[model samples]
Target: MYSDYHVHTNYSDDSTYLMEDVIKDAIKMKMDEICFTDHVDYGIKKDWDEGPIEYLYGQPQVNVDYPKYFKEIESLRKKYPKITIRQGMEFGVQVHTIPRYQKLYEQYDFDFIILSIHQVNDQEFWTQDYQKEKSQQEYIEGYYQEMLNVVKKYKNYSVLGHLDLMTRYDEIGNYPFEKVKSIITEILKTVIQDGKGIEINTSSHRYGLKDSTPSRDILKLYKELGGKIITIGSDSHKPEHLGAYIDEAKELLKEIGFDSFCTFEKMKPIFHQL
Candidate 1:
């Protein structure tokens, strides 16, 4: 059985699909479990336009509606027992959003949380529209440093959403990891130290990154560093994308020496042997 813990619903301003739409797709895919991780960007700078890429009509309070969202998920969970459904969120980690994230952590009982780095300072560095113009080395470096801070500050999150999400823009062309591996390793070491999971985000394939977020080499490195907690996700924002290529993700993890994948319930992990 497999579980996709990173997914989004209408609650994410960018998504127009409903929670039930996601559930129905999960059923079609014969997925064992799925979590709804809608977008919850805590602090986005107002001068976002000055950044590399242009964002569509600024996302607002994808975070605030969680209380109501939780109620909806709870209702869906009861109705969709054939396929396990859980509550989770994908949080955009800005350097200054930790306090708000911590406050949310204290109040909610979620199945999982995936912390992601979508912006570098105010830049929409994760998308190609902007990253294509920046130096690959510089963009990759910023991703590591920013992610390190996130792992250090948020102790409760289950996984780091997409370790090399900067590739979403393809601007990270032919960027050699040799010069940057140390920084990546350092950030991963902190994640290991903090006892969190790093996800194998399959969405990278959709974005044209040869290796899903964090590349296979980095996955090996994460494993070598004794960073044991790992999970797999499609990072699907739509129903059709919900369980896309999960079997491929399973194969990739095994090739990387992950004998099993993880699932979450009440904020705790339950490993399933592959």
Candidate 2:
């Protein structure tokens, strides 16, 4: 049975695809379980001095209608009993947002939550803004250090998304891999120690990165370190992107000595053999 746990719907501000579009594509792909992990980006609310409550404003909401989204998925699950449609969230874990872990965890009944380091102190590394100042190697190193902080701050997510996401932009600048290996390994060790799994995201391939995030070399290092908790994701934002290049990712994992991937049910890890 093929299960894809990482998928973004209209809920993510950057993605505009409809949720059903993704589900239909999953059916075409013959996936046994398709998790709808819409992003819920929480930002600090601007409040005036001496306010009664901490006014939580600037919370970005795209297709983030959770109630409607879940209702639709629940119906789809019943109709297509063959497919398990689990609800999940992809949280952009920042320093301030990290403290709200308890509230987020308690508020939602998510089957899986992918804690990703997308922003550092309000600076989004994904955008071209940060790239102007940091070189490719420096960018990657910054990401790794932010990951170390994000992973250590909270024990909230089921897996870490795209351990080497910076490579996408790195390709443009001819990233210095020789300089990143040590810091990458250091972050992976902390993830292993903190009981979090790394995701072999296929989205990198589709993103024109020509390879998976963290690369096969990094995956091998994780395995060699006695780290068995590895999960695979397509990171697809569109319906057509569902299960995209998953077989290639699976093969890459096997080549790196991983026999299976860890799945989550109610936020708990479960291993499925490759």
Candidate 3:
């Protein structure tokens, strides 16, 4: 039940946390399980062996080194038998990147895959490259529309990571949820119908947000719409962030009327009582 489903290691370009060190930290935190959901944004990042690598924001911008990543995970499992480790990757999928993700899914025996929209049309949100020029409605609509399209075409993921992720990068403050209610409803409906779930990312607390990553409103809507599967993650990239606010998140879910939360193994969900 105490599982951190979203974590990053040195394999992800933006992280420098060693995989072994992450395992040790999880064990110390009394975490029952942890998954290595490192980044793999094909449209924006290159695979480790895919020719010459380039640097971005102080690190070599490269996807997971598949061979080393899997090898180390296997090694760590045996070395740290007290804590369960699962293999996963965060695919920052865009509409055009679906094919690449599908190929990756076929190549690896992943326990989980977080389908995230870190960027759309190869432009990143954190950098404001995707939202700078477009009007608020245009960019908001564009973001959700791209997500809807991605969910419609992509089926390899276990859950949608940080459903309202754009809010994190939005410098304009909270955009009215009612304004994009219809599209959000469509996106959630598609996810529910496809048997996928969403995660309540606790990183919102670290970011000092007004609510959880998806916001309480979205979580309630998902419940009202008959969506069952949900997972909670700290989205940790550092030791201090590991397993952060997980208990608080579970409390929040209980407040929202969710009696159970999920963990994945071989891409199948296992529910635990809240």
Model 2 deviation from native, Cα RMSD in Å: 4.5
TM-score of each: 0.89, 0.86, 0.98
Report per-prediction Cα RMSD to one decimal.
Answer: 4.0, 4.5, 0.9
**Residue-wise lDDT of candidate 2 within 28-132, one digit each (tens)?**
878888777777555532212223333113433332566676787778777778677888877777767776565757866878888777666656555555566
Per-residue lDDT over 108-172 for candidate 3, one digit per residue giving the tens place of the 0 to 100 score: 89999899999988898988999988988888889999999999999999999999998888888
Per-residue lDDT, model 3, residue 10, is 91
User: Lowest-lDDT window of 10 residues in candidate 1?
Assistant: 45-54
Residue-wise C-alpha lDDT for candidate 1, range 157-246, written one tens digit per residue? 888888877666654366787887888888888888877778888887777666667688889999899877888888887766777778
Q: Where does model 3 exceed 4 Å of error?
A: none
For candidate 1, what is the TM-score?
0.89
Question: Candidate 3's error at 168, in angstroms?
Answer: 0.6
User: What residue pairs clash in candidate 1, if any at all?
Assistant: 128-169
